[model samples]
Target chain A: DVKVTQSSRYLVKRTGEKVFLECVQDMDHENMFWYRQDPGLGLRLIYFSYDVKMKEKGDIPEGYSVSREKKERFSLILESASTNQTSMYLCASSHPSDRTYEQYFGPGTRLTVT
Target chain B: EDQVTQSPEALRLQEGESSSLNCSYTVSGLRGLFWYRQDPGKGPEFLFTLYSAGEEKEKERLKATLTKKESFLHITAPKPEDSATYLCAPHEDTGRRALTFGSGTRLQVQP
Candidate 1:
């Protein structure tokens, strides 16, 4: 079975502190994505990587960065955590082909910036 | 810009009741439409993938159908376990691998 695992299910950080959320996929998918899910905003993409060391900014990329140093791992970095950044962060992985357009997601990390 | 919209933000049904969730999208060209089920506090799980109009796919109590402008996720004889937030996402031909998602339809099935 395809599996996506996140580094944490819940995280709390202080204002102005750096935060990191990690995601790993066992399916060896070529594409990885980071998204922030709000109550009414749905899932807004923050960043995505189609290959190692390659990243693209999504619609809401401000205040966030991503790292894809390895094929199976992707990370989302918050430069300075603020109250506005408190939201559910999700990580997903999928193949780059149209045949595998369905992305598999991790359980998610609920981050709280206090 | 590609956009996805889901209707009836929330739905309530009793056991064995049937209902349908709607997802409408506007894109340059449709590549695929996806359905996902998300439980509270968890991530979305893949349900169906529709590639073209008139395409249909089924899994147990759930059926998904697509048309030129929208897609429907029909739930039949839903049980309490069927309660979840149904999400729809569309992939366009813009060479981007990311999907544009709708806000989602929250379904509640009570016994």
Candidate 2:
């Protein structure tokens, strides 16, 4: 079984503060992704890393960035947190070589910016 | 542009009732269609993966079928524990590993 764990289940941050959300996977997947889910809208990709230190911007990458210094860990950072940035952040990992392309997800972090 | 759409935003069913959820997609080239079930405040759990048209996969009371342009998740004799949001994502063979997900169908089963 693939296990993906997030650092925090819930977080509250003040405006203009920096926020970091961490995710770790035990499956050693080659692909890691960050997404923010909102009501009425589905999961929108924020950033993804295919390999260590290699990152690509997803559909909504603005105000968000990611880091993949280690194979098992992926981190999402917010330069300046805003109320609009408050949403359910999800982390997922997949092994591209599997060909099935099914991503295993973490429990998710609900960030609230005040 | 790739698009994935799910119909009947929400559904309510009585215990022992059966129904199906729909997921329609349009992409450059079909690679795989994935189905996931998400409970409240939790991440999605992978259910089944459909690779091509006419492919079907089943687990317990849940079965998934794929066509050229759509996929259906048929729930048979659902129970209260079967309630959850069903999400479908289509992977396009555009050399990118990202998947475009649909808004999801929220299902509620009442005992």
Candidate 3:
């Protein structure tokens, strides 16, 4: 079974503070993604990494940045946390050749920016 | 633009009731459709993946079927544990690995 683990289950940060959310996967998948889930907006992609040091912006990447220094780890960074940034953040990983393109997800981190 | 839409924002069902959830997409050159179940305050759990029209997959009491433009998740004799939000995402062959997800259908099963 594949396992994806996040650094935190819940976090609280003050406005303008820097925040980091870490994710690690044991499946050695080549693709990793960061998404934020809101009530009506669904799961909107924030950023994704296809390989080490390779990153791509998704639909809503303006306030977020990601790092993929290693294959097993992906980190999401918030330059300046704001109340609007509070949401459930999810991390997922998938292998390119998995035909199904099924992404295994972590438990998610609920960040609260106050 | 690619889009995925789910119908019946919420559904309430009695235990042992049978129903289906719908997911429609407008992505061109469809690659795959994925179904996931999510409980409150947690990430989604993958359920099934449909690759092409006429394809079907099942697990226990849940069955997923795909057509050219939409997919259906049919639940049979659901139990209270079956209550969760069902999400669908459609992947397009646009050389991007990201999937556009639907808002999701929230299901509640009362015992």
lDDT (10s digit) by residue, model 1, range A1-114: 899999999999999999999999999899999989999789988998989999999889999999999999999999998899999999999997664558899999999999
Candidate 2 lDDT score relative to the true structure:
0.92
* lDDT, candidate 2, B33-94, per-residue tens: 99999999999989999999999999999999999999999999999999999999998889
lDDT for each residue of candidate 3 in A57-96, tens digit (9 for 90 to 100)? 9889988889999999999999999999999999998886
Candidate 1 residue spans exceeding 4 A from truth = none
My TM-score estimates for the predictions, one after another, are 0.95, 0.95, 0.95
Q: Select the stronger candidate by DockQ from 1 and 3.
A: 3
List the pairs of residues colliding in candidate 3. Answer: none
Where is model 1 chain A poorest over a 10-residue stretch in terms of lDDT?
Answer: A94-103
Error (Å) of candidate 3 at residue A54 is: 1.6
**Which lDDT tens digits does candidate 2 get at residues A9-86?**
999999999999999999978889898999978998999888999999988999998899999999999999999999
lDDT of each: 0.92, 0.92, 0.92
